[model samples]
Target: MDRLGDTYRWKSENVSTAEVAETLGHFSGIHEANVYGVQVPGHEGRAGCAALSLDDGARKDFDWKGLAAFAYQKLPRYAVPVFVRVLGTEVGSAASHNNKQDKVKFGAEGIDPGMKGKKVVGGEGDEVWWIPPKGIGM
Candidate 1:
């Protein structure tokens, strides 16, 4: 079974995916947001990750740092997503049979970049964005 459910532990804190998703949904350009936790090698617990579906015309104008800043204001530091997966479309890329996000699949994929990640979705639009510790300056 998938270790990650509605919540996951990170840095001795249990983060609520629903809360983070709600925070992300309010962002300007995101049409939808799927939040989950991925087990990071060498870490005691999982790290938060979000798979985003962008709104029309927002893809070209998406601001990464802006998103980071927005998240910083809206969420707790431990609750903020450490990784982001920009899904290709809002329709069928990562949806489950019930038309919701397939967290099981995303959880399995984790945060591997390069060819490994590309192989999971089989699409060129799946871009992985990382927020290294204190990398965003905000």
Candidate 2:
């Protein structure tokens, strides 16, 4: 049996990072996607967030709304990532020594723009992008 703790809960629903990552991976613009649970101030539980690496030149044309819509359609409401971070050119920067995606740093960073300058193991000077909760702008 699967334990709830193994899967983080958001809005009273269990969220599987691997499942979300797999769904996000289907998008052509996303070269790589890393999913994790992130603490949101005043929220009952951690919110879902995705760290994405865009394909070459895709940033110029990346569609945030489309991605949001896709996520909404493919995942449960609670599983849809509440935030997204766009990485810089070096996409593998967030990977572990074995090339596996690492979420510890990202989870700690949350969605604060103030955390921008902080450095991750292999991710120095990487850019981060996210949609504010208001959904008015990116």
Candidate 3:
């Protein structure tokens, strides 16, 4: 996991999701942008290539393709994120030393106006999707 952690550190320090999306948006002029990765089932190793979001980053109004292509281009074949989980609202459990802990059982479940496109990012019960590269254009 050292390499994975290294990559994460590099990404967090040198490139960010928003920055990547913004760059993709500037070049593509698309409405939505995001990057995700899929973890291999039964494997504790690194995740597979990322799944890009092709939607505008706006809630209730977005282009999911924009998110997809941006990720496809910036990430090597393997480092792309796997999920396009939308956070209806950002929550913070605790932040210390500039690091924030994950908030368990967080989502739009039972919460109105927050379930649309809701996805669990990382956890035991997280659902994985295999989105075909049908519409995203590089």
Candidate 4:
């Protein structure tokens, strides 16, 4: 693990979650972002996932397609988050007591709807967006 222990392996590439989060934070309407890795069934390594908090009143106007494009341009193919979780307004939902984003629970939750609960994100109406892997069907 690196200094932040935010590094993970995906597609035989070492991905730095902080780097991906920083790239995501640069996007408009994003207030804060946290990147982590989630296990994909039958996959060799963990897959990238990001949990983001948008600026006030930015949710309805957020452009997912545009974000995808921005990510593709700024990040490497393997570093781009495969799943995005739009978190709620509550601060505790995305941050911990020390004000640092926590990834333990989020990583465990992954992108599976069935794994989601009151503790995990992706509740009713909470947008969990996903981008298919390269050359894969939508």
Candidate 5:
């Protein structure tokens, strides 16, 4: 098993979680982002997943496609997140001391379409969105 750390391999390319998170932070409605790799069945490397906290005014009608476009524009093809977890404004377990983000829990909860939304994000209003292989334009 590969150790989870500063970078992870996906689609034969090394992906930097910090870099992806920074790219996501630049998007208009995203207030916070936590990027990490999660295991995918039958895949050789982990897939990127981003957990997001939105701005107060942007939650209801947040532009998902716009964010996707931003990510595609700013990051390499391999680094674009395959799964997006919406945490609303609730910090929950995504952060800890000194406001540093933690990716363990989120990483464990891979983008399983079978899992209920609230169970993975820990909030009734939270959501999990994912793009299947070749599903999205990315």
Candidate 6:
């Protein structure tokens, strides 16, 4: 099989997938979650941004700015989750744990601007902003 070469060279510079996932899980209030890298302007690492999918099925995408804000508020810079991409569909959990609906799958794109305040599965109650953090300068 062809080697799965590192598609994101920038990711090597900083931040690990484990760290990203852990941070997102702690902040998003979800047990199962996945964090992936996203490319952004001016950022050194492609993984500078992380897209997190939670276990409860509530997804929210946060950028560096947003992550930093969360970090400042509760977590440290290292624990700050950047570039979150919320998912609309449910994500599965690890084998040891029950297969719960992953909410972090809902990225910024999945959320509709009109439904920002509306309650969605795996998301906050109605009236909460669903807009991606990056869209609003994080």
Decoy 4 TM-score against native? 0.84
Model 1, 136: alpha-carbon shift in Å? 4.2
| Local distance difference test values of all predictions, in order | 0.80, 0.75, 0.36, 0.79, 0.76, 0.40
Candidate 2, pairs of clashing residues: none
Candidates' TM-scores? Answer: 0.84, 0.81, 0.41, 0.84, 0.80, 0.41
Candidate 6: residue 56 lDDT (0-100) = 49
User: Which structure is stronger by TM-score: 5 or 6?
Assistant: 5
Cα lDDT of candidate 2 equals 0.75
Query: Tens digit of lDDT per residue, candidate 3, span 1-138?
Result: 221222222233333343444455454424333332223446444332222223345545554565566556765434455444443333221112355322222222212223323433332222234434534443
Q: Where does model 1 exceed 4 Å of error?
A: 1-4, 114-124, 134-136
Order of the predicted models by lDDT, top scorer first: 1, 4, 5, 2, 6, 3
lDDT of 4 by residue, 44-113 (tens): 8898988888999998898877788888889999999999878775424656667777777777777887
Number of clashing residue pairs, candidate 5: 0
Clash pairs of candidate 4? none
lDDT of 2 by residue, 1-138 (tens): 753223567998888888998999998799988888888889898888888988999989988778877787788777888888877744466666777676777777777777754646434445555544434552
TM-score of 2: 0.81
Of the two candidates 3 and 4, the one with more favorable TM-score, higher being better, is 4
Q: Which stretches of candidate 5 lie over 4 Å from their true place?
A: 1-3, 91-93, 113-125, 132-138
Q: What is the lDDT of residue 106 in candidate 1?
A: 76
Superposed on all Cα atoms, the candidates' RMSDs to the truth, in angstroms, are 2.8, 3.3, 8.7, 2.9, 3.5, 8.8
How much is 28 displaced in model 3, in angstroms?
9.9
Where's the lowest-lDDT run of ten residues in candidate 2? 129-138
Candidate 6's C-alpha runs over 4 A off are 1-13, 54-70, 73-79, 93-138
lDDT of 5 by residue, 60-85 (tens): 89888778877777888889988988
